[model samples]
Structures are given as C-alpha cells and as structure tokens.
Target: MSSVKYSTRVNSFALGKGKKLPTGNEPILELIALAGTVPGLTSLELNYPEHFKHDSLEDIKEAIEKAGLDVPALQLRWPSPRFSNGAFTNADAEIRAEAVQMVTEAIDLCASFGADHVLLWPAHDGYEYPLQMDYTKSWVWMVQGLQAVADHNPAIRVSIEYKPADPRGRTILNTTGAVMNLISDTNRANVGVTLDFGHLLMARENPAQSAAMCLQAGKLFGLQLNDSHGVADDGLMVGSIHLAETIELAYYLIREGYAGTYYFDTDPVRENPVEECGMNIVRMGAIIEMARLLVRNHPNLPTGRALDSAPILWETVMGGKWNTTVSV
Candidate 1:
C-alpha cells in the first residue's frame, strides 16, 4: 500500500469552546500525548507563537519527543484581538514589523526540525465593511510582508491557508485564486498555498480542482482536512458531508504524488475532542485508502476514465472493496 502520513492540529484537543482558553504547557503537552495515541497519527501540526512562547523551544521539542511524535507544521493563527484589525497587512508599520518579526521567530523555531513548514492563516487581515479601509495599501503590505517572511529562510516552508470570511467579514486570502495570486506576487519558492478542504467548500471552490491548481503551480505546500456543511468551517469529521468531494480530493492527492502529511484542522467544542480527533483520523484514512485502491485499479483519477468509473469508485468506497469501506 502507498504510504499515508497523518497529522492533526493540537489546538483541536484544547478547543474547550465554552471554557476559558486552554493555554500554557500542560494543555499542549496533553494534546501532544493524545495525538501520539491516535492510530495512524504520526505527527502534529502545531499552533505557532502560542506554543513556542509558552514553553522554551527546547522543552517543547522534548515534550514532542517524549510523546513519540514529530512536528510537521506550525499554524500561524494571526487573528487574535491584538491582530483584529490586521497583522502583516495592518496599516500600522510597527504592528506590521512585529508580525514580520514573529514570522522570523516562528521560522527559527521550525529550523530545529531541519525543514518543517509553518501554516499561516491570515484570518483577520481583511476588512469587515466596505469603504472602511484602503485596499491597495493593505494588499501591498500583505504581499511584501509575505515576501519578507519567505526570504527569512528559504529552506523553511510557509504554507499560507485561505479561508472565507468569519472573524473578519472578508479575509484577504479567501479563495484559491487569490492565494495563487499571492504566491505569484511573493515570487518565493518556499511560500505556497495550503488548501483546507472545509475552507475550500466554504468558499464554494471545488476542492479537487484547487488541489490540482496548487499541484500544477508547484505551490501546494501542504493540506488540512476536516468536513463541514459548506456554510461554515465547522471542522466536523472529514467526509461527514460532501463525501464525493472528500473522496475526489483524496484521490487527487494520492494520484498526484503528494508526500506531505495530511493534517486535520478540526474544532471539537463540547464533544470529546480526543475521541473526535481520533475519529477524524480514521475517517480521513478510509477516504485516502479508498483512493489508493481506485488508483491501483484505475489510475486516471477524478477525470476521464476515472470520471466515467465514478459509480464503481463510489461503490467500492461505500460498499465492499476493502473492510475499511463499509457500505453505509
């Protein structure tokens, strides 16, 4: 069987929605330990700045090692109230400088892993209302800031994730096209786009198509998996909704030689986050395994013959080709 390297966001474990923000070493340490226990979960996509600042890099590394897992990516969540107005794209020069410096520091932290990537979610770097901001200036600052961050250490990967409006009425990197444009403007090899399946669905873009675009552009740095109703980034279990899209995306990744870790960016508010996360791993694995089988037997994948053989693929995935694919 082809290899599938699985990883998940540690913050999902500490989602604790109704409770106080889960902070500091203990919670994260617990998350690391929990991640290590999930079957097929080999690594973790960690929260940057927050995790790095809470514990010394040395200590954090030790914690991960102790948990028997590795860090594959660092998600730069740039939407704190401090960055509510903006972070890298902020009008304030000082804040923009601070954001750049933060990326530099985050890159430094990733250096210890030799070549790990960082996930950049510019969640708040957009406007909520019309005519309340200067688009041209903010766009320039955002791109230039990104280029600076990418140049900090060309070897370290910067995977910029795009999402439709949420905390902010409209996010700058809200679509695959916009993200591709940003990648073009940055003109840096190390900078790439991270297409989150749920987010893509939220944006009404075909996840499979976006994945292909990123692959063709040589900027598909990584990916995040989770399912939603396509209205919000609910971070539900992968394939829970949009089953065909999820299956197609899995097929595309495997068929196109994507070797990066399949990261799960989920939110488990009141549910048992640990169990919920583990379920995501199993569900995503099933989809990917189905894709592998489809490829082994029919390789064109999501196009041409594969498109014509959709019914068979669905049958195999939903019914009997493998025990993992139980008819539901």
Candidate 2:
C-alpha cells in the first residue's frame, strides 16, 4: 500500500508567524505555503477565524492559489456568537436561527474556496448542570439548526466533530455513538462525522475501533490526526502514544479505501508551532511507513471478517507486546 497523504490545520501554525503580525495578512495562506513545502502534504485545512475576515470569497481563493495549496477542508470555530457559548443548542429559537445563518455563510465561503468539507465542532453547545437543561429540547434545536445549514448549501459537505468535555463540561455530541445518532437523525447526505483521534482517546474509545465503526456507518468524512496521553486532548505529535494502535488505524483506513484528507489538528498554544508541526509531519510519515510495512509483511491479511476482527489479528502479529513500551 502507498503512504497516506497528510494535511495541517492552519491554526496550528498561526502562533509561529509571530505575535506582532497584523490580522489582514491572512495566516491561513502563510500556513499553506509552509505545508506546500513539506514533501508529502497533499492539502491544507483552514479554520474559519483565520480566513473569515476576508472581505470576499475571491480573496480567499486567490490566497490559496498564491500559496500553491488547496483547501481540502474548512472549520468554523469562531464568530463566537454563532458557534461558541452554546449558540447552536440555545433554548431560544432566534439564537438557533442566528447560528444556522452563521454556518450557512461559512458553507458559502467553503464553496467559494473549493473546499471539499466544512467541519463543525459543537464543543460549547452542551450542559454544565444536570437539570439545568432539557435534553430533548436541545436535540431538537441542534437538528433544526444543522438542517438549516445543510439546506442552505447542499453542495458543500458538513462534518460534525465529536469531542468529550474537557476545558468545558458535557458537550452534546461527546461520543462517536452520539455523533452517529445525530447523523442518522439529520439524514443528510452531505453531513457526516469528523473523527479526531485525540478526542476519541479522551472519550476512552479505542481509536481503531472508532475508525472501524465510522467506516461501517459510512459517516467518516474526514480525520484529525493528533496524539494524546489517553487523558487530556494533548494534541502532541502523532504516534506519541498508542503507537501500535495508530499504525493499526492507518491499516484500517487502507483496507477500507478511505481517500479523504488526514488533517493534523494540534494546538500551537503551548509550544513552538513550526517545530511541533514539522515533528508531527515527520512522525506521521513514519507511521505511514510502518503501515506499509505491515501490509507488505502480511501479504494475505484478512479482508471483511478478518479485518473486522483486527484487534486479535493485530495482537497476534505484535505477539501481544503492542503496549509493552511507549515510543515517545
């Protein structure tokens, strides 16, 4: 099997551009230019806040062209009133409508930039107290809001990212199961799931298992590549933890014929952005290399049933020493 290509979220490199830079220079373009220089990078992911301020879609498109990179995906993380602070699942109908409008605008922007997908992480749209909110009402609100966005732009794909509570409390769609349920309820062809490996680790879901489940459900629209300490969403370099599991997950993707972009969704808040991103790229390349070796070494590896029972197969291949030591 050939190596899986990788992409980087521009937010991961914004801090490295220097703190004194003006906002108008467009950091997303700068990050794309950087990633374009990376040998195996096939695309780039741009978050909303970095490029949403551009006056027109043509400007954003021009920046991407100038950077020599394509925007494979776009994320809506800002315009705080619409996304953050529980606007999508707010109790008020007007608030929900506004949130839908914000996302619709984002979808339009995605179309303009030729982005393949739009990512929505409903992190803040959840309850902080048990009895303070109504579960049924919140689900209804979220579905309605998301439907509005989907209906507005059927051409662009929208992916809901699942993240368990951490810097916050009880996100609505905190698990892969919950996200799957949302996709079933919404029943939109253009709406799917964004599997973030770190978030799955934080949720205590086996990353390989989660990937298999999403693949089975036909909801795996995109992937966020990052490593975690199995506790918090560390966003460290790939293969930092769960080394064998990461390799197995890559094998699964290869078996399932997943052709979507693999995005590195780490944070640059606490570390040197460029250095960390470069390390992440190198680690990911190594992981892909290992996956290729696994496939080559096990020429007759299972398909269907054998692939479904991959945990046992993987354990047998590793001689039950998959977790014996940490790599990083």
Top model number, TM-score: 1
Candidate 2 similarity to native, TM-score: 0.83
Each model's lDDT comes to 0.80, 0.74
Whole-model alpha-carbon lDDT for candidate 2: 0.74
Among these predictions, the greatest lDDT belongs to 1
Please write out the lDDT profile of model 2 over residues 1-328, one tens digit for every residue.
Answer: 2345567866566654344233546555456566556555666776675566654556656766766667777888644545455767877777777767777877877787767688997767877787866889888888877787887878888999989885458888888999889988998988899899999998989888888888988789999988878788877778787787788888777677677887887766656766777777777776665666667666666546743446544664465534535589
The deviation in Å at residue 33 for candidate 1 is 2.0
- Please write out the lDDT profile of model 1 over residues 7-40, one tens digit for every residue: 8877777776553246544466667777777766
In TM-score terms, candidate 1 sits at 0.90
Q: Which stretches of candidate 2 lie over 4 Å from their true place?
A: 1-4, 16-32, 54-56, 81-84, 268-272, 296-328
TM-score of each: 0.90, 0.83
